[model samples]
Target: MIIQPKQRNIAYRCPECASSIFGIVGKFALSADMLRLKCSCDKGSALDINKTNDGKIRLSVPCLFCKQNHSYVVSESVFFDRDKFLLNCPYTGMDIAFIGDEQTVNSELARTEEEIRRLMAGFEAEDISELQPEDMNEDEILPDPAVYDTLRFLVKDLEAEGKLECLCNEGSYELRFCDGGVQVYCERCGATYTFGATTPALAEEYLNIDYLKLK
Candidate 1:
């Protein structure tokens, strides 16, 4: 199924111009660019990411309430690190996802400008009905806003500092990550902590929040 833009829904309709607001994200081949989010009204914006992250892929489109656009840099971990990670992209049925980046996104827009211009020209001349489709059934299930905001800040920082470290407590421990689920165990302490779980307590260890919530 095609990924539908979130804005066309009745709920996100604008009170001012009644224009739809949407946030789209995708990457181009071999480039780190966040595709420009274009509105039917000709409003376009770009975002930039610092390359130090060198992560896989990430995108943060603005909310319906606010039109400011933002982009993120993430690595394969976003998809591969999930608890029940799907091996493929549902929209394209592809093994790899078109990860979003600002630079890559701009290239796509430039390449497609002619097609887009044709569409826009038709739109300007005709009094066309709003071809708003239904909202997508499978929205990107991001973390709850309160929680997601913190992860955006912490995950990269911890990963960058090489501080996402795991130390063995009194008990023997094991660490395993496959298909997005991880297992951190202390065989000596006979303890285990799943991501974001605080259960299976360990005697002595430094743990990240994702690992602590598994309880």
Candidate 2:
């Protein structure tokens, strides 16, 4: 006997670019069916349709890397037949992250959101005046404006204290950006220091250090 599969409409949004893609998918095609959905912006996601142990349909989606929040949408049979579908960042060709099941995914998402809220509360309690710029001085060369400004100010502060000098104390240094990070090297003593913002979140933490004591 041959049984015809069911069809449903599923929509996806990129996590990074927030671009949307929609398509009609089969409900009972196979246990592990993957449909590649690419947004017009070039980023995409592979929607995997699988059957749970309890004979339920499952959809696995990849999330974005840059964004802090994970997004999802739920539709009755037309979209996913379930409560929700995993979302991915649209800037990249593929989703940057994937979790096992929906239950675990929701739990993880709640934890992540709560952590972000707590961190924001902590940041709000701190004196952020020093971190804020009074004037507009933007450097297009640096990937992160905050890091560039902070390092520039740190150098000026160290120079005023005569501590920006290399180990020889008479050597001069040069700062440059490379491989998405900043590097400082001395011409006379060959002393070098590098600050990298490998991820967006780590950029500020890297710039918040005392660079004068790198002897």
Which pairs of residues clash in candidate 2, taking residues 3 or more apart in a chain or in different chains?
Answer: 14-89, 14-90, 15-88, 15-89, 15-90, 16-89, 16-90, 77-81
State model 2's lDDT. Answer: 0.45
Q: Write the per-residue lDDT of candidate 1 for residues 1-215, one digit (tens) a residue.
A: 75532211011122223343333333232146544433454343332222235555444433222222233344444432322211111121111112223343344334434543454476673311222223433224321232222333344444444444434433322343322333444435445454452222321123344323222
Candidate 1 ranges with C-alpha deviation above 4 Å? 1-32, 45-53, 70-73, 79-150, 153-210
Q: What is the C-alpha local distance difference test score of candidate 1?
A: 0.33
The regions of model 2 sitting more than 4 angstroms off are 1-142, 198-201, 206-208, 211-215
Span of 10 residues, lowest total lDDT, candidate 1:
6-15
TM-score of 2: 0.29
Q: Which digits, one per residue and each the tens of the lDDT, describe model 2 over residues 46-97?
A: 4455554645444555343333222222222323332333333322212333
Q: Alpha carbon lDDT of residue 66, candidate 1?
A: 29
Residue 35 alpha-carbon offset, candidate 1, angstroms: 2.3
Q: How many clashes (backbone N, Cα, C below 3 Å) per candidate?
A: 33, 8
